[model samples]
Target chain A: MMDFLTNDLLLLSDSAVRNAIPLLLACLAGLYSERAGIFDIGLEGKMLVAAFAAGAFSAIAGMPAYDGGWEMGAWSVWIGLGAAIIASTIFSMIHAFASITLRGNQLISGVAINFFAAGITVLIGQHWFRMGGQTPQLREGQRFEPISLPFAESLKDVPIVGDIYYQLISGHNIIVYFGFIIVALTWWVLYRTRFGLRMRAVGENPGAVDTAGISVVKLRYSALIITGILCGLAGAYLSLGTAAAGFGKDMTAGRGFIALAALIFAKWKPISAMGATLLFGMLEAIGNKYQTLDLGFVVLPGQFMQALPYILTVVILAGFVGKAIPPKAGGEPYVKER
Target chain B: MNKNLPKWVDLGLIPLLTLLLAFAVSGLVVLSIGQDPVEVVQVMIKGAFNPFGIGHTLYFTTSFIFTGLAVAVAFHARLFNIGGEGQAGIAGVGVALVMLSYDWPHWSIALLVGTLAALAFGAAWAAIPAYLQAKRGSHIVITTIMFNLIATAIIGYLVVGPMQGEGSQPQSERFPASASLPDFHEIFGWFGLEFAKHAPANISFFIALVAALLVWILIWKTRLGYEMRAFGHSEKAAVYAGISPLKITMIAMLISGALSGLMAVNTVQGEAERLLLGSVEGAGFIGIAVALMGRSHPVGVLLAAFLFGILTQGGAELQFELGIPAQMITVIQALIIMFTGSLENLVRMPMEKIFIRAGKGATS
Candidate 1:
């Protein structure tokens, strides 16, 4: 069974795994703030801002190759990564202030963030870059490169199942490997750590966490900053690490919300989120492959194929996979009495 | 000191701030591009609101009114109808296709039929999210956003595909003369302007005004409106009062959809008389800002919509005269939305006295 499945679906599955990495990274970013009860729905905007910053910064670094040097090229990627993190952090702070300090509607704040990000990025991109976006593209040598596993070439000579690991595990960018590591790391931080426990406590019962002498504001800020960093990486991966060569307005698309759906579908568990992202990735990869399959008279419009995940997301939320509950204080902004 | 203030004081303050901010931001952008900021503002002002600018302002306001109301109606039910632009665009195409493909006798009758068709199209477009929210218990915010994306793609394909215009651009064929809305300046001759002769403002403006008044009456003086407000104030309270959340949601979305469809009527049967992707642009989302600024009141929405209309025209004029981007108005408009939305959430009570009086001054 494994042999047959591997032979037929290995390439598609490999591509699905690659696609899911960035989405999984984004979901973890959402999970961080959400588990701490912040409901960072502006994940989409944050990713866009980061992508713009990363792409432009990397490009400015003179297309420096990743040869481990402190040259202008090295400074460029470093600056790009730094800018991506800072931009997303600043963007997330808007959400934090609106959802946390002002006690405004979290959803409205998120919408505002989405609008502001899109407007400002595109406006800046068009006016300043003369590129019609927030920034310019990264030069090829400055972008992140794919890392192949050792012995995978030789392992492909083995029997049916051997082809699966060789293809799926080996044929991915370096960021995909980090994305898998992030999943494991996130699971560890969420389940086995004190901070994770307190985050869950605050999300489920802020009053109880407050009663237990934890600073709800401090915990939430930390969660969001971590989320900011993760989201930056996701954006970077999307623009510089994936097939995309540059940034575009709303380039994150609705992947942020899809990741949110994945977060919910996984019941907020990091490991489950990884699995759910992979499943969604599989859906996308299979959809792409299915377009080429001539079912004759059953050729689905490619638009519908692109919209499949959203349709499924609506279905899942509607009880196709039963009810998925959010954090108790999901969108509530905590106001400190002192 | 004068004691009596204007009834529209609250509405006036935000647009003023928005204007100031927009000019300031545009000035900065101009400076960055090595242009004199002050000169640019002067040009923009001249272009958008000079004696010849009334026609475009009046025509644009006609559609703005419906899109703004579409958003405002949903806010009453606490639903974020961000798909207003997409809905308007889709319905505009629907009406344009029908009117262009089949000839109709009277322009008014064509408008009426096209508007009804647009309403159906808008409702179906909105129903995707409404159904998810009603039956699946999915969050409307996320689902509606998803719909906006899909709608954009669908509209893009249609305009560039089966419904593609005869011209090379991605636009539909112009509506027949019999199907178009009557020119307002020719029909009413109320707002006297020499520019009206160049490009006439039409009857759609008055229709939008009537729609605003109707929405006002519906919201303040009707049972359904009361139920919607109740839902907005407290979903649980509404449910306790025997109102089904699902039913109200569906109704709210449908009304919002229809309002957006009316805006499409102005686009297809009024002035533009053709369909183009993003022609409606972000007006629907901008309606959310208008609704917020108006406090979701019908009269407030009307006043706010007009203010936006004026700014939009003025901003364009500034660009034509100044060589600055006309979209500077958008920045100022967005800034106003941000600050006003924050202002709406600010606590009214004095904090110092309360904190001093009670150690536990945590409550709103």
Candidate 2:
């Protein structure tokens, strides 16, 4: 009985791990900027832009050789990822400028960014790619390949839990493991370091931080920039690592908000944020799993199941698990009076 | 600095600059893709205003006006109600169910039922956040957005599952004839205006107009409106003034949600006879922009909604005539809104100076 339970959990482990990476990376990205008192609501827009850029670049890189151009698909994927990071980073600057400098409302700026990204990406794809706003599929070697653990075979027949080890250990993309490491690194940087302390100080009371010789604006800007880079990587993973293609309209699909919820639920702490992300991941996994298993009873339609995470978010937010407070001065922009 | 600039120039600057920037950016994309940007604009304008075009634009605007008002009402109370899409949608379902079941003669009954459903559902949707704010102090913005997602999923499931229409398109069945509003385009066509023959302009537009006016009166000339505005300014002060933030939020959200339901009537009663999977795409979200541009006031909202309605209708015309994707409207709308919402900050320096001068005058 113990062996069966262990095997089942092991089998589910890979899916859970795969599901958690995107949210984990995004929440960390959000944690960095928001921790420093700047609200980065444009994470969704940043992700969508990067995903499209990476997909288009990869497609171009892998396209059939024409006009004496080198037919180098692998090189294009790398370049595409790099371009995605740059493109998203540039887009993040708009939010930075609006909130950090002009002190505009962060929510409005973020929503506008979301609309702008969705519209432009769809328009460009339909007008250019001619695939009805979808990018061409990348050829093998052009997309990130799943890495299987070789040692899993050696451990498969050792004991009652050996099969569990094999299923849980093998056949996941490279980015999944890296995403976990990033979460840990993010937690360490957010809680255990001098920078984290300053960020917290800036968020709670930027005026105080400023009085103590820290440039509140500079810290916020740096945090936003860091967020930009992380969001780019998360977007790349969505298209390049998981689905391995171009994006659809609203592709980030409010995942940025989900990450934000995770951020708040964890009380702006990176490690707790990981816990929150996993809880979300578990929701998503169960939603997907329930679609396949009728469980001897009628289930709600897939659409309802799909909305489960968002509903759970609302419920949790509405005191289902008590309340989650944001960084004290999150939405309010700092305006130093001359 | 000289005060030679026109009073309207300050307002005009943000809109004009936004247009210029959007066009410039779109022009770059057009140039890169080997399409003439000027040609695209010309096509859009021609498609938008050619007599036959205005009717369709009006038809689309009827719905936007309601959604815009819904967002604007909540804005007055300083609440974010992103459930406009869901509220409008669920209310649409409510209308569909009523039409499918009832045999009423007066369209008023159906309209009442639909509107009430929208208000009830929208209020319920928003109540989650209100309760959180009252009890646990959660931000309404974040919770409302999450509600939007849940609303989308729930509505999507309903249409595809229990509410599936006779057609295979994962939609609701055709609403009964009694439920539909009178089509005005047909009346105009009887006067030899062939331009109105194809458009779906109906009595719903007039209803929407009256609704907007009524909203204006309720917001500006009423005691409740004063309390709402006060709540928006400061919750602590509002509480001190004996205004219950919780009650105001709930009332505002219900009114907002009801207005969003009217959006369904515009579509189900006037244009489409049934509800589709993605009926009220982003009107709820765009209404935030409308409210912002309109400054959450009724008159401002109407103008903003009309302008956006024209753009939307024009984009649909472009899709039919020039084969351009309708998504361009989204980009343009986003650009316009982003610039407009940020315009207050842009003119803050000048406003401050003016205020300072006014203060000096009073002192002197």
Candidate 3:
């Protein structure tokens, strides 16, 4: 049991943290939109397109090859990350235009954006690479190599603390480290800034925000843009780190919705959302592990682990667990004078 | 902005113009992809309108009709039931259970039992989300969305685990011959006309029509329908008028779930003759677009479903003949939904002003 705990569980915890990065980023993405009164079910789609952009662009850029230099010289990976961010931000502008400018149903607009992203990524991908809508697997130099912390090698002699530090925290891709920074930054922007106050107020009561002489449309658009950027980062993280190999159709695979669930489970706070996403990721890691764990008397199917997050979401939403409420003005288009 | 134009403009002309705009955008995309946009249009028209194509179009039309009405019913109650995908998927399991269990001597009995099973399973699947939304103040959209993912997992388990057929395949054994719905060709043969063997259009087409009519009556005539619409329009007003929000939410979703389940009768019973994974094929999500385009009316739902049916069948032809990818169909569909559903005011507000000016000039 001690060996299992020391070795098996440590590995699982590390994998769980790695897996949680995209979900955390995506949750933060969703936080911006819902907080500012736009409901975005399109986060999955944005991330998908971003992943495709990241994979496809990096492959093309790094085709000439890279000599090992600083951090393995994976310049294409960083470029791809940038490409994903720009592409998703531009795509998200569609949602902003529809839900904000047109006074359309935010939910319907979001669904359309999801559809648009799913189709466009595959369409463009198939046309460009001709690999049945998939990007070619990245060569070593094109991938984000995990970075070991400075003390990760030196601290191995210490017992549990060393194991936790070296095994758990030391060897994630830079994107994973950026995820923590993103969450902290999100909390600061949402709780500690005037813009955050206005954004939150707009979600709660757009009418009040309008009365206070703030531009509701502009603020909402800003939030949408931030949503796009964060989702782009999530997508970049997936193709560059979690996947770190290639892009395929529907690759985001419902992580966006899980992020939305985390947003709700966290009650829409960035810090709590980080915690919820990690817990969700932990369930997924355990689920992946259950398939291989040797249990003599009991068998666990992979689908059960896969289904747990959704089941938990339903239970929580059903008031069976605890109360959670969305921003009051969410899913409603703000009309200047109604 | 104009308040009044002939209702025809709102119901018919607006959708048509938005469709034109969507096609125009799609045409640009086709051009950018190096395909001839004009050729794409020609292929779509020729492919969708052929006699063989009509059968397949209506076959898809049948499935969309059920899902569309399901969405429309929920819309009347201001509830977005996007779980039609999962509802119809699990309903295939319900359909398979009844059809495979008993060897009914007659197709009618099998049909009845299968229909009941599908309805029960779909309704049951929807009930949890509906109950949560009603009693717990949970968002209906999220609960239903979660249910869709769960339904996929459940069906995956059931098909591979408990219900796997004797064959090596994950699918169940085909239902006995008596369980099969009569093909449209057979019905057409009764009139001494030949129909396409390739297309799977079946008598579920007529059943879908009946379901649409029933939904129309339910929404426009029933007291419960009045209450549902009342709550949808204004919850505060509904509270003042003594309608229970919880009751309305539950009943609307139940009815919606039943209609969505009815789609399995077409896909499972009429077409595949067996349950399969992804049998719903995003019809549940497409139902949202259908409801939006149709304005959530039964007649409009029928028309919108038929339009999408044309696009889908036509799109297959584009793939086969012109080498256009199938994802283009999805893009076009998304553009249509975007333009008509969300960007509606983009077309409407301008058109409304034009109509207002035209009306004033005519009066003057």
Candidate 4:
């Protein structure tokens, strides 16, 4: 057991953190929208559109044999990232339009958005590439490359500390590093700024904001836009970051939904969102690592571990760990006259 | 929005108009891909209505009816049952076990036990989320969706590990012949007419019709349903009237789950004759659209299910005949739901204004 925990688990922990990046970004994405009283369940939808956009842009711009194509380069990843953000923004705007402007049932609107994304991505991708809804694999230099820290090679043999720095922290895609920075920035912007306070107030009591002469619609729209940005980054990272294996149909693979669970699991706080994401991601990585690993006692099913996060969400919501309260005005469209 | 002079326009005209607009937009999309929209429409209509295609259309309709009723019942109670997919999927296991374990002499006896088992399993799956929402204040929508994913993992394990057929395929053995539901062709053959040959449309079609009728009677004629509707309209008022929110929430979701589970009888026993992975497809998701378009009424649900059946069967022909992608059908379905539910006010507001103008004209 000691041998199993030290070496095998350390490697598991490293990949766990790497997998945690997209989940963390997605949870943070949901933080802003729900904070402003707009219950956006379209996180999955937004991410899919972005991933498809990123993949299509990269495949189009950097394909080696395409007509008049430039050699694949780092700029392709940047262009892909930009395309993802723009595409996700447009998709989220439709959600904003229905949930906000139309004052429709937020849940129904969200379900529609999810379907729209799944269909549109596959439809367009197959039409463009003739590759059964798969984007061409990115060549070297066309995707994010793993970066090395100053002493990563030298620190490799220094026991636990070495693994922590060299294996876990260093040599990750640049997006993983940026994911952490975004988490901190999200926490700061949410807790430290005047805008954050007002946004939280809108979720709690949109009536008070409207009475105070603030534009509830405008505040909510901006909140959703921020949500779009984070969701876009998560999607782009899935397709273009160093961890990427190119985009395929439904490649986000319900990570967005898992992130939503983490958002509520974190009690809607940004820092807790990060912790929750990492914990969930670690659960997944461990699940993959311990496939039918037999102990002296009884063998465990890997799927049980893979399903831990969702089970925990259900357990948490069932009041085992106290109430998981959402924003007070969530799922309700703000109507001034009412 | 509810204070309208004409009930017909509210329930009938708006959905029709929005459906037309949805199709117009879909036509434009098809046009963008250089396919002729007129030809597409013609092909879809012909494919869906042709004798051969009608069997498949009705088979899809059978599945949709159960799911639609599942959603409609829950929607009436102000609860969204998004886990119908998982509920139906889980129900497949129960259905398979019932048929495989029993050496029943007749199809009817096997179907009876299988149907009950499916309901029990689906309701058992839904009971957790309902309990969480009723007792612990968890949002039903998110919790149900989460259950959907959990159901996938469970069925994955069941099909692969515990219930795997001797064959390498990740499916159970084909169901016993005595347990298999009779096809439409067999039934029609008794009367000397050739119909739905080799198609999977079965006795479940009549059962679906009966289920819709039962839903109508239950919602309109039962005291329990009154309390559910009362609670949905105003929980505070229902509490004052001595109705229990906890009781209603659990009961509503359980019934909803049973209805969704019934869809499995059509797909697993009636059609596939075995428990296949991904057997539920996306019918549960489409149930939301049917419920919305049906206005959560049984009659409306039936009509909407049929309309969806046309689109599904017809969309297949469109793909096979014209090389148009099947995703176009999904896009159209999404647009229909979005337009009917989310942008309903867009159609309603204008229509309401027209009715108001006409009312004033008639009076003045």
Best by TM-score: 4
Ranking by lDDT: 4, 3, 2, 1
> When only chain A is evaluated, what TM-score does every model earn?
0.89, 0.89, 0.94, 0.95
The DockQ assigned to candidate 4 is 0.71
- Expressed as tens digits, the lDDT of each residue in B228-338 for candidate 2 is 989987989999999998788877877888788788777765678787777787888778778877767777778888878777877776677666678778877777667
Cα displacement (Å) at residue A179, model 2: 0.7
lDDT of 2 by residue, A35-152 (tens): 8777766778888888887777777777777723247856866766786788788877888888888888787888888778887877777776787777777767566777877787
Name the runs in model 3 displaced over 4 angstroms. Answer: A65-73, A292-300, B1-3, B357-364
lDDT of 4 by residue, B205-316 (tens): 8989998998888888999989889988999999999999999999999999998999999999999888888999999898998998889999999999999999999999
Weakest 10 consecutive residues of candidate 4 chain B by summed lDDT = B1-10
The CA lDDT of each predicted structure is 0.74, 0.74, 0.87, 0.87
Among the numbered candidates, top DockQ falls to 3
Model 3: per-residue Cα lDDT over A36-72, one tens digit each: 9899888988999899898888777777544322232
Docking class of 3: medium
Of 3 and 4, which scores higher on TM-score? 4
True contacts kept of each: 0.22, 0.68, 0.74, 0.65
Model 3 share of native interface contacts? 0.74
**lDDT for residue A22 in candidate 4, whole number 0-100:** 86
Q: Summarize candidate 4's per-residue lDDT along A1-338 as a digit string, tens digits.
A: 85666678778888788788889988888999999998888899889889889888876778665554555566778778889999988877888888899898888888888888888888788777767788888876567788898899999988778877887889888888899998889888888998898899999999999999999999999998998988899998888884455788888888989999999999899889989999998988878877765767987677777677888898887779867888999989999965
